[model samples]
Target: MPHQPIPPPHRTYARAMRAEATKPENLLWQALRNRQLEGFKFKRQVPLDGYILDFVCFEARLIVEVDGGQHSGAIGDAVRDRHFEAQGFRTLRFWNDEVEKELDAVCRAILHEAEGRIG
Candidate 1:
């Protein structure tokens, strides 16, 4: 079943992200922080309009989302994806399992995508 889209709590969620919903995000952030990953700068838990992104690189107009099993299906995710695409941001989604079980692969995929955008 598709999960329901929980609209971001707007501006406030941006500030409280550190305390409110930091874990799932942190698991990814820890790997991307501090100009890491071949100097790829990623911003975490960033607020963009009505959404909070797992990771973003404004220069690349890229939004990388790490989704858990509960986010399965096409309904909610599709809707949210359309919104982001409409706003000129390209989104890349990966399952949490993929990130956890295939960390190097996930990192390589992200780098490959970024490289594609660069050229």
Candidate 2:
């Protein structure tokens, strides 16, 4: 059965996402785009149902979020994770520092996690 389309995000939310996605996306996106990592494709700044995700690996059902200072010590992250979990998508979060300071490590972690999801 085809899934019904969820309502579009509010206009302000969509615009903010576009601006943030272009301006603040982590380095991981560069590596993920164009199938640079093990031929896995990723979409950046995507809308999936009610929320917009930083990066989504659709085939693997993984959502990667690059969080900034605001998310630090903020419990809302867990709540958001639960929402994605309920929808059958695994959420991976990396702080901006992790991506900027240890990009190679982040890339490896993503690869490892994705591998586990495969047969």
Candidate 3:
């Protein structure tokens, strides 16, 4: 089992991460923040189970990850996904390039999944 996350430290780290978001992260955040995408609110760099999610829609129980090349075939991600799944959260992963090059499609996919969960 994964260790329980200490909220205070994790929150601090999440804040720092938000401040240093990558270009793709920034682009995706702009599209996901507030109620910009299909009236669903997204919070960036949210900490859960000692992991910071790129974006999350709490109401929809959806976690969106904007991953770079380093994440390809990462076993840690698979473990994290299982952990989130056990917490009744669904994760959607998109490559950084996909977010940068095909942002509209990414947003549409997120909206579609969120709608299924929320509506």
Candidate 4:
């Protein structure tokens, strides 16, 4: 009998987060899923480097975060960004309200960034 390894804690948490996504996350996911954003593949609620990223496109090395009011001026975010940057990934953050109100603009920015990285 072979034993299976348990999934990491961050992976489990990320799965739960994907299942119960916030409104803004949902909105963004709709735009990013199925390579809809300029043929770039995006995965939501992905676990990476001990953190659960809201969305990540490995090919483009981009991570998108949809933040709420609680995240305003969060110092911890800077540390996380630096860590990801060191891994050669750029992080793009948008407020929840910004996503809800300016979904097209948000998608455009994401596409632009992803294109830049991919190219």
Candidate 5:
């Protein structure tokens, strides 16, 4: 029998997060999954650089985060964004309410950012 290596903690955590996605995350995912948004592929609960991103479009180097109230004015988020930026990726964030109330606008913003980055 061949030995199977255990997945890293972050990878395992990411998988867990995918299974336990929030309502806003699920809503946004429906809009982004299967290349539904302008044929751009988006992945949910992706682990990268020791962080678990809510959604990521590698081709576009864009990351979308659906945050709840706990994330408002969070300094950690700023640091995370800077880290991703340094890695040549852009981070986009939306509040839970925003996603629930303005899903169309959220998708539009994501599409626009993806197009710009893809360009």
Candidate 6:
């Protein structure tokens, strides 16, 4: 197996970040938290492989990122994606606007991707 980055020892920081979830993240979390979507359990602000994932479904090996404008074409994101991919995890990123404007569609897409991975 390829070497993967390990999660940093920053539980305090991660916990603080989780407390201040962005609007888009809060919105999506309403749908994803507590296995609300198709019974697929999702966790918020999870620390994994040296990154704080916005949302994670461990069973599906899926990491969902609700990105703001700053994330567009970000090289760092590419590197993060590759790191998770190396660990057999798939990442799905959605813009803040997309999540805010088309929440239903985004949820559908997330559900589809998660189901595909699960099945």
- Candidate 4 versus truth, CA RMSD in Å, comes to 4.6
lDDT of each: 0.74, 0.76, 0.91, 0.91, 0.92, 0.89
Task: Rank candidates by lDDT, best first.
Answer: 5, 3, 4, 6, 2, 1
- Name every residue pair that clashes in candidate 2: none
Q: Per-residue lDDT of 1-119 in model 2, one digit per residue for the tens?
A: 23346555544575677566633374677888998989888887776566677888878878888888888877877887887787777898988877888888888988887777765
Task: Itemize residue pairs with steric clashes in candidate 6.
Answer: 7-50
TM-score of 2: 0.82
| Candidate 4 per-residue C-alpha lDDT over 86-113 given as tens digits, one digit per residue, 9 for 90 to 100 | 8889999999999999999999999999
**Model 6, stretches more than 4 Å misplaced?**
1-9
Distance from true position, residue 21, model 1, in Å?
Answer: 4.8
**C-alpha displacement of 18 in model 6, angstroms?**
1.2
Q: How much RMSD separates candidate 5 from the native structure? A: 5.0
Candidate 4, residue 36: Cα displacement in angstroms equals: 0.7
Assess candidate 3 and give its lDDT: 0.91
Q: Model 6: per-residue lDDT, tens digit, 1-119?
A: 64445545655667888899898989999999888999999998877656788999989999999999899899999999998998889999999989998999999999999999988
Across 6-104, the per-residue lDDT of candidate 3 in tens digits comes to 689898999999999999999999998779997898999988777888899989989999998899999999999998888878999999999999999
Candidate 6 Cα deviation (angstroms), residue 119: 1.0
- Scored against the true structure, residue 101 in model 5 reaches a CA lDDT of 99
Per-prediction TM-score to the true structure, in the order listed: 0.79, 0.82, 0.92, 0.92, 0.93, 0.92
Model 1 agreement with the true structure over 1-119: per-residue lDDT tens digits = 22235555755676687566435466667777786767778887777655778888766677899887778896877887888788777889988877777777877787777767766
Which regions in candidate 5 have their CA more than 4 angstroms from the true location? 1-7
List all candidate RMSDs to the true structure. Answer: 5.9, 2.6, 2.2, 4.6, 5.0, 2.1
Q: What is the lDDT of residue 41 in candidate 6?
A: 96
Candidate 6: Cα lDDT at 33:
84
Candidate 3 off by > 4 Å: 1-5
